[model samples]
Target: MSYLLRCITCGEEYEPTETRYTCDKCGDLYGTLEVIYDYENIKIEKEFEPKGSIFQFKDLIPATSHTPIDQSIGGTPLYKFKGLLGFDELMIKFDGISFSSSYKDRASIIAVNKAIECGADTIYCASTGNAASSLALTAAGTALRTVIFVPSTIPKGKLTQLLVAGAEVIPINSTYDEVFSLSLRVGRKKGWYCRNSAINPYLLEGKKTGAYEILIQNDYKVPDYCFVGVGDGTVISGICKGFKEFYDLGLVDSVPIVIGVQSEKAATIKHVFDKGKPYTPIIEPANSVADSISVGNPRDVIKACKYVESTGGHFISVRDDEIIDSIKEMSRSTGIFSEPAGAAPYAGVKKMIRSGELKRTDSVCIVVTGNGLKDTDAVRSGVEVKTYDIDEAEALFL
Candidate 1:
């Protein structure tokens, strides 16, 4: 009924201990969500349905509860980014517009359901923007009280979403780690059910749905590469797990390369992979206008690095100017509006093309993790859209 969930760095096995968020031995320093399941008793005789998500292969998910409660969050749109430079079959599975305008909604759906099954009256998490917005909205729907701690750099659109929802949104005027540390302490001290990605392992199950959907949409074929821009590494690790599961099932002949994207200014995952060791986050972060990806000492740096090495992938870093360009390009071309970090994967795609790393035959997918409305200000370098009477507007155009 269970599998030994081990630490990625030390390989220390663990049990669900004392309602704690992570292993006492490792202390979850890498902030990776590790869930191991025993597939021994799972019937090899039975074939898993490939069309749907966790519903198709519920056993692979470590969530204690299986609810068909919501279909809107996990099954996101998978589209092709036609005519990308240096890549012929380049495609992107845009997941930013999930029910709540971010991929975090999927994880919250699963985490909150588990919280409900465990008889929890309250759910808590720490977020920068999208996660907080999604968690608050999900909690409101589930009739659970949510307490979210977020960093102060979050944009107005995201703040507006939280304020409109049923949550006690607290803005922490510090780095992402500080917000997480405070959330961890309060969740432990107050006996609140934790739903934050770094602390709760179950969140990974929901994030894996994005990967699952991508495979299903491609007729059970994995892409050549999957580019994910990281904030906490939860999304990328969850995706790695999903691909590993597919490889185990023989559904895919090979797994896709997992490319981790980061702002060149704040490239923690890149540093650890480049160093070939268990990398620690430096005290200071490189400054970037993309406030969403501005993380110092990301919690999942170690796991992210391991994913890159084992999966035979590269980490691509891009400038904030590139991110802005991506935002504009994505909006103009695909009608997809994304925040700065959300646009970062597109920037990675461009960077790959410029470096001659992309191939014409290789099928690629870049996950847009959040909506542009999350950080509208980041894309405000140019004049905003204006609607006016034809007489005046035409004169200006002339």
Candidate 2:
């Protein structure tokens, strides 16, 4: 159960209590710390059975205590889809069923619990939409106050969730990258606990649980590939970590090839992976219908790239139209509705198959990160709102 924080860039180690976000020596983006557990000393029950809550894997989680939130946080359903999307074996991890109707709840639970554990009264973060709402939902009735900074273009449904949860919403007329920097500065000045998953190491621990659940639900069978939408890169990083942990414990034979799916409009991570270079701050604005993954310069690009490459995975970028089309295709085919970002993985899968990078026989798992209801406006063009009179409706029956 004991662990140490290690800087990914400099390979420096520190006691868990010594630092919060990053390494003091490395600083900022490169200073991002990763939790290194003592795998040799750890032990698990022989008859281990996965449970409905994330707390079931508390032995692997970093927190000593949990928040008093009543709602269940993790344990989303893993559904199988045969002969769908032109794949012989396809599975979707529907994290949209999370408490906040988004996958970000996995990280929010840990962040909120960490805030309380540190005796902090306020928890703040900058998010495109899902993460903000997830944080607000997790800290709703807790003593911790939630403050969210978001772009002005955030969907009304997400804003409504934040307002209903009593979070102090700050809308900035700027890109997500700018808003993120501003939030980091303000959070540091105010000494508030930050829940941004990109910089927070403990939040990654929460996210890795998704990978654990996926493997468990599939009867410990590791899939050939895992496709996830990439934004701040926290979700994919956490997933890779989870699979690595399972592999470390000798539970699974190997890790899946984790493919990160991004919008072509905001494919910073993809570009970096293609170039074989370190992350540099991007100035171009990233505008996409997939608001959640529309990040110009992801802060967690380093870890995201490292983790993906370590598992022999790569990045794929899909067009906005492709993502929109996949939203409809996924919903009609599987009865599972996902936001644009959540559907990006499906689009990427189609693209890869067309490019011959993916084969129809390969077992694939697409992670649906958020619920479709989070951004109904993005799908307006693909759907119709129709009204018919009683007589007109009856004519169709004839």
Candidate 3:
């Protein structure tokens, strides 16, 4: 289980104790580090038995302790949909079933544990919604205090979750990029543990578990492609890392082509990917119905682009209307309700299929990142209410 932290930007390596966040030479988001395991020394069982929580993959995770604050942090179901979306095989990984009703719980649990392990009393994070709520929910009952900085545009449902979890929620009137910078500055001055998954390398380790679970659930059968909603790019990067780890371990034959789904209104990652260069912070404001993925300047853009490109996957952006429509379509077709951001992958899938970019014969897996209830207001137009009068109902029936 020995591992070293390697800077993704520069070829700098450091022991875990040397640097906890990023490399000193290339500071900031560009210096984001990744956990590099000694695969040769690591061992796994030939008959891999899928476990309930992410702790089952302790060997791959950075932490020494496998115990989690929330037991139901991982193991979300991978529901299959045959002939849906006109694809030969389509599967959705329902990650919103996590404790916080979002895929972020996977990272939050580990980040909180890391904070406690480091003897930190407070954890600071900047999120659009899901990550903040997930951190708050995971840090609850623990000695660590959660301080979340969110944009003013965050949905009420997510804010409610944060407050209920007792986290000190601060809604900034500025954009998510501004809030992220403010939180980082304040957290650093206060010496708090930064739990922002984009910069905090360890948090990515937790998200990778989802990829592990997907492969395990399908009996080590790697899908042809995986579509994930991208905001700050941590989730997709972590997923790619997970598939790579399994492939390194000789568990899976190949990794899936990971397609990052983004809202056209907030397509920072997509823009960066298309540019074919290092990430440069975007000044444009990101306004999208999918609040969770509306990030103008994603911190994990470097890793996200690198990992996706490594898998021969490309990024795709969908319209807000398409996202809203996909939410309803996915719900009605599969009985799984997802937030606008969560449903963006489905929208991307439809776009790809329509443009002939995706083959109908290929098997696809869409990682739904959050529950629809997280931001019900985003899909208000999709819901219909019928008020029935007893007399009218009876007369119509007669």
Q: Superposing all C-alpha atoms, what RMSD in Å does each candidate have to the true structure?
A: 2.6, 1.5, 1.6
Candidate scoring better on lDDT of 1 and 3: 3
lDDT per residue as tens, model 3, 7-111: 998979989861268989988778989999999988886454455788778788876442345567788899998899988779999987888999998898888
Misplaced by over 4 Å in model 2 are 45-51, 277-283
Q: Distance (Å) between predicted and true CA of 19, model 2?
A: 5.4
Provide the overall lDDT of each model, using Cα atoms, as 2-decimal numbers: 0.75, 0.88, 0.89
lDDT of 2 by residue, 115-153 (tens): 888889899999999999999988996898889999998
Whole-model lDDT, candidate 1? 0.75
> In what order do the candidates fall by lDDT, top score first?
3, 2, 1
TM-score of each: 0.91, 0.97, 0.96
lDDT of 1 by residue, 1-398 (tens): 47556676677677744364566667767534477777556653235343344545566665554344465556667877667655666667776667678888878888787788777878888877888888888777776789999988778888888989868989978877788889988988898888877577778777877777778777777898898887677788778777877677666778889888888887766776677665664544655666666777566666666766678986878888888999998888878888888888889978887778877788898888888877878878664787889899889979
Candidate 2 versus truth, CA RMSD in Å, comes to: 1.5
What residue pairs are clashing in model 2? none
